[model samples]
Target chain A: MTPTKTAPQNDLPEVYIDDILMTLKYFTDEHEVHLKIIDPQVCMNCESKPCVQFCPVGAYRTQDGGTVQIAFQSCVECGTCRVLCPNSNISWKLPRGGYGVAYKFG
Target chain B: MSTKEKLTFDVIVVGAGLAGSAAAAIAARNGLSVAMIERGQTPGSKNYFGGALYTHSLLEIYPDLWDRKPPLERPVTESGFWFLSKDGMVRATVQGGKMQNDPIDAYVALRAKFDAWWAEQAKKEGVFIIPKTVVVDFIREDEKVVGVITDRPDGEIYAPVVIICEGVNNLLTQKLGLAKHDLKAHASALAVKQLISMPAETINARFGLPSNEHGLAASVMGDVSMGLPGLGFLYTGVDSVSVGVGVTLEALTKAGIKPYELLQRYLNHPMIAPMIAGGRLMEYGAHIIPEGGWTTMPKLYTDGALVAGDAASMVNALHWEGTNMAIMAGKAAGETAVEAHQKRDFSAKSLSAYRARLDKTFVMTDLHQYRNLSHFLKSRPDFMNTYPAFLNDALGMFFSGFGKPKKQLYKDILRSLTDRRPLVKAAGDMIAFGRTIMGF
Candidate 1:
């Protein structure tokens, strides 16, 4: 079968920054956010990383020199990479309770 | 924490499946003290589906869920509809890899693990979750619901509002007269599923998976139903594959065909057998799905109480959408509860907002759009009969090279169409199908 190319229509709004800021205040203390933010260099650069393309939310983006950066706040906890990755480098877990995507329509 | 036998909540949600957990999480996050009750050993243990979690509605609740470690089996990159006859398949597929990028797209999930995680999220938001406790009935006061009566000793937990997110076995909803006592078998479907264990490498090779990506295949057997209104599905899980068939109880009973036999035949199909070859059955289970769509939706809200999820029969069969509707309805109910609490009025009038919200959401909108489909498909057996065979025969003939002239082959295919169904009737059926099932 020929590979089908389709546009990704499900991009998250840049306003996600605001939603994350609000959810952080409601569900967690600033200390937790600070602790999680300490690891800015967590992404180990891999040539064939599936997360860059497989993340349903488009949360992973490659920056200058191929460094992988994740917008941690927008993660929905779908656990796709945890099971898909052959290298098993992705540490997957649910967002801190009461904090991530609140699926209104699941 | 005070276990003083006295605690009140803004909302009491029963059943911690997709709907219940979503309701509790959304309500509590809005700053309402909520209580989620589950009867299962854990949430999701009792729930199952062809099991795709569509993100459109879930995105409203968890906008950033795609970025998080979601409880997803595979990011579905390919979706197709298959009309299968004895030896032919008519297929239509939209190969949009970009469609999976939407944070709110669908995800394959197992209810057992997913529900537990959802319940935990609700609890983290201070939503008191009482698991292993069954809500026996709604505590009605003066013809209005006030709280719930649970199986727990001294388990009369009172709340101003209650939302029922129970799955298809809606015992309480029926008891409360919210829904009819006995549903028409046509309004429901009995699905028997098997989880077949297979090696990951083999699965990837068979289904053509790219690392974590997955594929879904749904087909309708022309004669497998034995003239019943139903379909079959095969979804790829991480280590196991889920295969099943669901027939309407009315059809199954009328035909007297055992569901297991139908499933066995489906598995034995030439096209399906090779895919599941060498796989061992790890689990076998059956469940009921509300196929009633919009017509079967009960009076959704009452004084001080609301009904959400499958309890309301909010399933859209056209796109095989359920879990997202359940979660969306739960969120809407939660928001309504917040509104009612703020006004200090949990009357049916105040809770009617839940209905209004559903109308605006895809749950009700999509169901209403396909409202006539279930009945249409039932009335027209061609969907399960002539169409699949036509597809199969046409393809079989087109691929067959018996040295027949191309002109004669085209004529032969046209003759086959008229032989199975009159051209006029087929055209009419196609038009009706497009209008109803396709939501045109």
Candidate 2:
């Protein structure tokens, strides 16, 4: 439950998403080559960028040329970008068994 | 393994999450030649959860689960719920082992380790586990799904029946038009979580836990999501803690905050920061949960196919359980498929028994009871927002002990709350909340 409160002091937790992802790289069972780019025509000029708005990992983003870009490696397989895309444009599939994250402490 | 063999079985279970594993294991044990197709290299590699597992139903399937000595993190013997205000907090906690014969209701285990063990168990029971194979779509013949088409070369595998347990995002269900093609974001909650590294001694000192006892299962609200109906949870492992936040998808999108950023906000909250003061982050990930309860459920069964777990939307959101429901649902579906296999009938009529089985279990009963929960929160977002703030303020005022008159203190507290939301609205909200949760 997100609650409103006084501002925080910006004390950094010793954790970093980059470092966590790096550690996950060691446990990866296989190299990922499964994810496919969605039809660019549908994503081009897309302003709301629903995929960007809902992805928890910030994997999807609007790029310089009005094209949508996604970093599959950063995905923890949350599937939000796949499920909540307004146009249903994200053609998501399961990363090959053992190819994606082999979570050490899931 | 390549698809060079005749790839046919009595039943094919897709996606090796908890639900798929349960379905495959149960079906194979019941004398059905089951093929458990996993998109992961093994079970649990593609799965994630909130670090809690109710073992009652899982135990029902593998009565000797402990005999194998699976990689259980710790037997969860204590839990708490924290309602936080800016400076103060109110908490209610339960001691697990206190229930004399409850037999350890749940445990904390890492999914990657637990799932791999579970899939291995299924493989031992004669279930053909095809790891690293992705089931891209179903092969239907005359309106009956007879096989699955994977992404591999000649990846079509035929089966009389198929159990779809593809987690929350059931793309196969969507392709079959079982669920909506344009499902809304609000239908699920977006959960982002991290695993933090903390020494066992530090955990014991911090949570006041005995060396032998397991760690706490604590939940937090307020000041974690900027007044959004998001929740932060903390569950400890032997050497780590799993901390997470789950906000309604609609709320997160409307707030325009990245999930990681919100998670950082939770980590920085004055009340929350101290709990994990010296811990280092180890793992981070996110998932969409079926918190919409029964209301957002898709069709459970069709010709030659049945959906279990998140694919069937079987999560009891209020109770914070999906794995238990998945286990029970998969068990029921497995039993139903066994019946169908005996009769050689792969029709929806035969599979309706799966629904009947769920109806008799908490999976469906509790789901139906709280079918209106998502609606309630969507209508009145303040129960998680305004009420918490007011409650915190009231507690702070009443406990200040500044030598004010008791009667005046009580009056001031009432007046403060009523002034913010009015007595009439408060009364109405109470009634509404009662009706929504109590199922009036």
Candidate 3:
């Protein structure tokens, strides 16, 4: 028998809302969260920019002039951009407690 | 306090993920004073999965949970298996009665909320959950594990039994000498998933669900991985979709394939594109699942401690079921701990009952039966590369009517199978696969 009809829908609120609220609270003092690395020039700044496409929440975006920018507020820290990136441009780690994407259904 | 204020509990459970929460819940329910420690800020903040909860084992633990409001999104009504080629899909579907039942055959959930709900349940059952607390090391009294040392200030907890439900990265298990430190990449699978947001109505309509019902599709990318051993899946939830790909880390390293690229290819596939179109990607995460099954399971019990969940490597990948096994193992471990506490014996000999209980249960049975399947799949490149292409080719020819008769289509299919491995090998593989993994 097909198992499609039996899936259940949760009535709770979206978990990401909490994540967003937490992010807001975490970055209340700062506009942007920056990463410290040995060399900013290490980023090859690939024309295609795979991180922009791989980011689930569009935290990484490419400007018209082809510069990559990260909006830390939306970053869920799923680590996809770091693992998928061909170059070691993104230094990823877990977000502070009560911050980042709070999945309601995870 | 000299930075060493010691605390005590009847049981100490590490990692507040699904399995740990279940273990803590069961232990507390059995009237044992329990301490559940989590490294994350919350129970599920660090957890990731292509989430599907098989309710069988959960119902065994909480029989009346479904009678009230379940922390479930949608009841899965349909399931599909797709063998995908470069541009086409060869499909097989199973639907109806047996899959829909009282305890809910399966439910898709977001772990962050689901896990928190589960942890809250455990707390209600009298589990003292210490969140944001990292268990740094196993406190050894002689050769036996007597307690754990947390990173928190004044955080040494003494317990007769410590249940390690620490997921795939079992550092403490290795440190405590319960499991081997050197886990081969072949034994681990790297899975990456994304939660895509969509309107609930849109999701239900797109997946053809009636009201709150849901659908799931598990796809095998034949030759899509360039001969890597892995698969992809997409599960429909209430307001979103969970889609991901998992490949053996060794195979991925060898092939130089990126998991996200595999995910993109999966999403772009003709068969998958329509279903997930217009959905905004909401969350993305990755995890290493111990796919070694029974062979990789550690020494489950040691002096003064027991192991459960992924720390014990209890995942059953054949059915894409791990959470259920983890929950069941946790429950069993909790029951065993309770028994030991009553008898006041936490020696390795007494705690060995956890292993016995697991052996008699479906967790070990399923794991042992499918123990060889991962190896078989890893060894057989054709299962990942050739069969999918052949199936898609045969199906394409069978369905196309380009001024050709049915007999001609049959001849075309026979021709497609000629240069490939002999039909005998395919038949043998199928039989072996059914016997070992499917237990048929």
Candidate 4:
């Protein structure tokens, strides 16, 4: 089923990522940028700002009443924020082979 | 010399996931030179899913890989489905090894480990692999397909044929004009999953498996997806259990629910909380799943190129059958590439033998049979929310057997069904369900 969104279900889970990242591994030359917002203006005008709410891991968050702030450090690369962005504000690229999160159990 | 001038290999397989790796292996094993290009540091590092690799297709591809102790969590010997409401849960179960003389041998292996291992097998069969490279576009010559252009300097790699298995979101397939550009939310489902660590004994005990044995792929529906036509899953790994939920992007946008909260709701469901109470959160992942089935699948073959796996919209949403389809389609593409090479024909006609193989297999037939399911689901969005919840309530009350007699209980359930919606619409949904499943 295409999952529906609102009931204000976004109470964040009380899990810590610092511990999780300790066990995970990766083999990239450096932690380079892979995801970027295409248009700052598009994000500023988004009323619903669906991308902020729909991302599974909260990679995106609201800054002030308008702008969007990104936390790429914990991004899981699910492509949810990119697909659900109502304003087409997201530009997602595949991380260079073996660049992102290394799943101990993907 | 430059990549353009140093042409080699007859075929280049793009992406090293299940489909690309399989295609590379299949073509190379048949004595054709193949090069597999992966965008991740390794083949499966960027790959993720709440998935169980169905062994039947893999066994057909690599009969020997199974006996060599491939990195597998466990053979899912049991399975369960749940209907969850606010305070109620209803479950249906299937637990056994043999079903009608055939074994249900699905193993819950992590994709990172499985794909990496599977690609090694391709390497063993003389398939060359280049990792950490992204195929930015296809190298077009005289309007026919040739090879791929990667992110590296002078990254153009040329060949007579190229197979695209770059997964659900890669734009290379779109650039090649094999698939529609800008895939919409309705065409895909979004998945959010977490790996939770626990003791192997604890996993077995909680999931009701024999000591030192594996568990089942447990899936639940109703409220977990927040009313989208989607479901939640709990898969038992060797020392961890993966729990998550998925919904279509359109549904997710309309409902405005966050994916993690839906996951939290599933984890905290009355039936699920106890199973992973003391576990540690190990990993989190999200990916777009192709759900358009057969009706919306892109063209399978074009001049000098073939597309397979999620990139071609080759997933069966109802059965959660992506990996199996990917492997089979990849195999077909490999064989077809070999045939095209032998005949020295790189046109769409030569590569279309892949389509014939797919049409004759379970992949295409099953997809064609269930093509209308996504639309039917959209028509009755309540199938995920209101109806399933009602089913739970009705069944709960009927079985509660408080003070009412059986006849009185039957009447109550009948009245309740009509109380929710117009009886005519309910009947239409019922008919739709039957017709969709029966493939009418």
Top-lDDT candidate index: 4
lDDT by residue for model 2 over B357-432, one digit each (tens)?
8899888878888888777777776666667677888888988948899999999999878877888888888898
Query: Which candidate, 2 or 4, has the higher lDDT?
Result: 4
DockQ of candidate 1 (2 decimals): 0.01
Q: Cα deviation of B54 in candidate 3 (Å)?
A: 1.0
Candidate 3 lDDT over residue span B247-292, tens digit each? 8766765554445556666677677789889988776666777888
Q: Tens-digit lDDT track for model 3 on A19-58?
A: 4233221222152243222234444346445555445444
- Candidate 2: clashing residue pairs, number: 12
Least lDDT summed over 10 consecutive residues: which range in candidate 2 chain B? B96-105
Please state the error at residue A82 of candidate 3 in Å: 14
- As for TM-score, the candidate ahead, 2 or 3, is 2
Compute the interface RMSD for candidate 2: 4.5
Which order, best to worst by DockQ? 4, 2, 3, 1
TM-score of each: 0.78, 0.91, 0.82, 0.93
For DockQ, the strongest prediction is 4
The model with the greatest TM-score is: 4
Candidate 4's displacement at residue B184, Å, is 2.0
lDDT of 4 by residue, B1-440 (tens): 34356656799999899999899999999999999999877878878998798888888789886476678787787777888886677877687636212445688879989889989888998999999888888877888988888888778888899999988885777787777656667868888888899999898888788854556787878877766778888889889888988888888878777666667778877778898999998877778888887766888889989999998888887777989999999999999999998899999988889999999999998998888877877778778877878888789878786887889888788777778767798889889988986678
